[model samples]
Target: MRVEQIYTGCLAQGAYYIVSNGEAAIIDPLREVKPYIELLEKDGVKLKYIFETHFHADFVSGHIDLSAETGAPIIYGPNAAPEFDCIVAEDNQVFELGAVKIKVLHTPGHTMESTTYLLIDENGKDHAIFSGDTLFLGDVGRPDLAQKAASMTQEQLAGHLYDSLMTKIMPLADDVIVYPAHGAGSACGKNMMKETVDTLGNQKKVNYALNQPNKEAFVAAVTDGLLPPPAYFGANVAMNKKGYRNVDEVINQGMTALSPEEFETAAESTGALILDTRSNGEFAKEFIPQSVNIGINGDFAPWVGAMIGDVNQPLLLITDKGMEEEVVIRLSRVGFDNVLGYLKGGIEAWKTAGKETDQVDRISAEEFKERLKVGESVVYDVRKESEYEAEHVEEAYSRPLASINDWIKDINPKEHFFVHCAGGYRSMIAASILQARGYRNFTEIEGGFKAIAETGVPKTDFVCQSKVMKA
Candidate 1:
């Protein structure tokens, strides 16, 4: 038996491939199904199942398309109300895959339909548990995401999660492997461990959610400090529940190469947002005016979902050469399927055609600190509220990137505000959005707060976040 955790770093999501004898099963796949198909073909295995742990909110799952292409039935846990055809397996039901068995453990905490799959090896010993969002290595899934769908408050869901972990999960053997759906950097859980796989015994000892002595303690622990789910999360969940355009069709429509003029005309006609997926440094140097930058190299997909706020927003791409297809695929992963096309020859083509371009001034963190010392600049710490409260420059404003749309209005556009995130990734994103909205006179700190902290700038640590609010 072979189990492979196909981890996508951008989404911090893990899709599992389980194979035994000549049969294979996929658990919680990404929107792009081509890679899974190729793997199956290469191994000469018959695709037996597409297992969905839950209707995910973060990225569009490939179950529908994978099933359609391979004739494999999509399986869900009880209470799943997907519009499409699927087998809703009951609790404790076991499915045979060649020499091994996968038992469904209906652990509905993350979502009403959330389930964990227990793999029993050919020897009939429980080998591993694919703990989908129900249990992360260091945390349990946040219960708030399913509050609306389950008609239960986050506290109630947390209670259920506690029961699921105690009854179904914690009873497993010490050596049983725990494969979680998401790792650190995912919003699915508050405190996921950086490691993707851990032994169940280790989790029981270290994971706060699992170590809770009572349901009340568990609920309070799990529900605390959840930031609002990204705006596009619900839409992605809807698409996953209903169904969506085939991955191939979406790619074909989006990967069209258009000349600079054609790209601009399509943007005008379609009112598509131009998304530049180049590196932060390159995008800061030059880009089409108003094109938002979420670099392909960083945490691209989740940031796209968080910032764009619309799954169906039509987008045109200005990607580095040979990156157009990748940008489209990543966009589709977050349910942004309405990509119009891409700039044919990238920004160089636009400049060659004498098109007006825009650039944002970027400075090293040291230079930003010098400016701060001279009282020549205002700092806008665009990291999350939690990050700012943890540590920030003494006078930096607490403008989070997640709520940039609302906060952008409160600040004067003409004022010079220096922006930074933990590192440079999110600050550049903030800078581009500000630029698109006609906010100039700002500089992006090259190394963000990490570098700023190193520069001996006056800094403060807040005992409570509310104390540091910037007006």
Candidate 2:
């Protein structure tokens, strides 16, 4: 028997592939299906089932598309009512996968239909549990995301999560490997470990959610400090439940490569937003005017979901030459399938075609420090609330990039502001959005707060302990 965790860094999501005796089962797949199909063909195994832990909110799952392509039935845990055809397996039901068995543990807290799949090897010993968002290495899934759908408060869901962990999961064997759906960078859980796989024994010892003394305590701990989920999350969940455009069709439609003239024409005709997926540093040097940059190298998909605000916002991409397809695929992963095309020769072609380009003013940390010393610049700390509370510039205003839309209204576009994130990635994203929205008088700190902290610029560790706890 072979079990593989296919981890996608951008989403910090994991999809599992389990194979035994020419049969295969996939767990919580991403939107793209060709890779899984190729793996199945290469292994000489048929896809027997597509197991969904829950209707995902971060990225559209490939279950519907994969099932349609491979004739594999989609499986969900009890209480799931997807609009499409699926088998809603009862708690403790077992499904055979050639020489092995997979048992469904209806651990519903992350969502009403959230489940963990226990894999019993051919020897009939429990080997691993694909503990979806129900359990992570150092944390449990945040209970707030599914509140509207479940008609339950986050505290109530946390109660259910506590029960699910204690009754359904904690009783598993010490040596059983725990494979979770997401890792540290995911918004699905707070304080997840960087490691994707861990032994159940280790988790019991280290995971805070697993060690809670009582149900009330567990609910309080799990429901604490959850930032509002990204704007596109609800839409992605709906697409997952009701089915969406075939990924192949989406890819075909988005992979069109338009020359500079053609790309400009399409933008003028369609009113599509230009998304430049180049790195933050390179993007700061040159880019299409009005293009928003969310570097493909960082938390690309989640930031795209958070900043774009609309799942179906039409887009035209300006990508590095070889990364066009990757840009398209990652956009599709987050249900952004209306990408018109990529700029064929990239930003260089735009320059050659005499099209206007804009550059974000990025100053070195030293320059920023000098400016601040002169008492001429207003600084904006665009990192999260916690990061700001931990340690920040002595006078910078907190304007987290995640909720930029709301806070942006408070800033006067006419005044100059210096923006920075933990590093440069998020600051550029904020800069791009500001640029697109006609806020031009801003300079992004080249290395963000990481570099600023090193320059000995006046800093403070003013922890608003109570306010931090409330956030």
Candidate 3:
């Protein structure tokens, strides 16, 4: 038996391709099924089975498309999967595909239908178990998503999660390698290791979720620090159930470039919005002037999905060559595919053609501090609540970038707000949001809060995340 791990970095999602005796099975596929199709062709393996650990809440899944393309039956656990036709896989059910025998284990907690697949390799020995969301390298997925607020309290779901971890998943052998559906940088779990893989034995010793002395502590740990899911989460899940439109065919139909004058006509003709994936500095200094500034450097995918509601529409790229194809592919991973094409040489090409350009002023942290010393400008530390609690600027008031727009609307729009986050990425996001919301007088403090601390700005014990030392 051969096992291959497929990683999608942007989403920190992992899917597996297992081949035995010329038969292939894919577990937890993303929206674009082309990669799996190509892998099968190259390896000369026939597609046999497709399985989803649970109906995902974050991204639109490719299970239906894989089932349709491969003619392989799509399987989910006994707990109901919404939106698609599927075989309800049973616990302890053994299914053979080529030389591999797969035993399904029902492990609910991440979601009601989450499952673990135990694979017996050709040598007739137990191998890895694909523990989707139930367990991770060092953490477990938050139980708050399906258990919505005010209805099923966080404590109730945490109890269910405690049971799932203790009784269902912990019984597996120590040697069994654990393959989790998600890794670090994923919102699915709070403390996933940066590594993509781990073993049951290692996680047993280190994973805080399982290391808890009892269910109460375990429940408390997993129920916190969940960043809100992208605004488009519900829409993507809805689309996944009804079966999303074909992104490949939509790409094949083709799109054309247009002058600013022709842009309106193209928008009328093709119905695609021009997406500007540039830094707030670049977007602010100058632009095509009509595109939406959703930079590729930050959390670009989910926001793009949220802003561009229709996946079938054409996407005009307003990014430099360094960021173009990547921006397109990231969008594609989330099932957006109406890419007409990018500006040939980016905005510079259009500008050289005598087209108009737009501009906004961006300032460094040093300059903002100098201004602050003179009492001319103010700083808005735009980070998340958890992030603010972790660490931030000394004098700058913390306002999470996610909700900065709503926070400052009642105040001055031209308030000399200098923003920052854990790193510079979120400051860029805050800068863009301010730009989009017509707050042009703001400046993005360079290097975020880190820069302020580096300058010897006095801060508090809460300024840096030192509690991990206790852990």
Candidate 4:
């Protein structure tokens, strides 16, 4: 038996490719099916089963397309009662893909339809479970997803999750490896770990959620104000229930290169978002002020997603040629097909074309300090509430990026908008978000709040060399 973990990185989702003998099965497939196809073929396996632990609320799954193209049977938890190419899996139902034994456990906490796939390895001695959302390495799925499609309440879901983790997941052998459907930065769960996989025993010892003494505490821990799963949750669930359309096989699917003027014109007309996937410092130096800064560095997809909650709009990208395919593929995996195209030749193309550019205005720490001495510049720090309370620029008004939509509700949109994140990536994102809302006088800290400290600029609210909670 062979098992492969596919991390979509968009929403930090984990999909699995499992095969035994010459048959293969996919669990929690992302929309881009090419990777799965490649893996199965490499293993000399035929795609026979496509199982979703539940109807995903985060990103659209490729199950529909995979099923349509491969003539594979689509499987979901019994409660999904889904209409197409259907197989409703039941608890304890055993199946096989050659020498491996597969068992399904109905664990409906994250959603009414969530399930865990327990697999007995080819040797019949090895045991592993795909604990899909119901259990995680350190945390569990967010309890708030059941707003309406739920047959379960928050308490009910949390209770179910607690039972699933303790009763079903915990009973597996100590050495049995555990694979989850999500990792950190996913709104599906509050405190997901970064590890793609973990052993049941390691989780039993180190996982905070699993370590809780009772069901109530576990439920309380996992359910507490877990950030709302992306605004796209409802759309994704509906797409999954009805079944995904075969996007890759859909005709005329290749992306085009967009000229500066053509792209800018499209932006003006259709309100497309221009994403600059350069480093935070590079973006702050000068960029089309209209662009959102989501660097091509660490944790690209989720951060890009954190900035833009809506994928329905066209994504016009500005990046080095090296990152074009990556950016496109990441978005495609998450079902972000609204990408109109990428810049024909990145920012240099616009420069060569002599097209006008806009820059997000920035102020150095010293310069800002000097201005504030006589009150010329009012620094509005755009960090999270938790970050603000811990330590921040003395006079800066705090409005977190998470709450930016409602930031200007109290202050008029015409008010000076000076936004800053730790290193300016988020501030640039915030500034352009304001730009989109017709706020003209927006400025961002050049190197972010950290730039001031690092550059020997004046700062009154000095962080006292203590570790901060990584929120």
Instruction: Give each model a TM-score.
Output: 0.96, 0.96, 0.88, 0.87
Each model's Cα RMSD:
2.6, 2.0, 3.4, 3.4
Taking the tens digit of each residue's C-alpha lDDT, what string does model 4 give over 1-471? Answer: 778888866468888888787998888888777777788777888987888888877777888888877888887775777767688988888778778887888888888788898888877775788878787777777766864777567888888778877778877789999889988767676656778888989888987788888888877766665554555566667777875546653212325678888878878888778888887667656667578777777456655555676757677888877677777766665556677777888888888888767666777756655555424446677765546656676667888776676666666655565567777767766776676566767667777777666654445664432123223
Judged by lDDT, which candidate is best? 2
Q: List the residue pairs that clash in candidate 2.
A: none
Query: What lDDT does candidate 2 reach at residue 164?
Result: 93
By summed lDDT, the worst window of 10 consecutive residues in model 2 runs over: 462-471
Model 4, clash count?
1
What 10-residue stretch in candidate 1 is worst by lDDT? 462-471
lDDT of 2 by residue, 15-69 (tens): 9999999999999999999999999999999999999999899999999989989
lDDT for every model? 0.90, 0.91, 0.72, 0.73
Residues 1-471, candidate 3: write the lDDT tens digits. 888899877688899999988998999898778888899999998998897787776676778778888898888886765666778888888889898898898887777777888888778777899988888888887787777522576677778778877887788788888999989767677778889888888999988888888888877777756666555555665666567666565444333444555554565577567678887667767875456777787777766765555666677777766666567667766667668766766787777778777654556657655666523446677765656666655555767655554675755874566666665666665565556557777666666677766665545457454343211
lDDT of model 3, residue 345: 69
| Candidate 4 displacement at residue 303 in angstroms | 4.4
Question: Can you rank all candidates by lDDT, best first?
Answer: 2, 1, 4, 3
Q: What lDDT does candidate 4 reach at residue 305?
A: 54
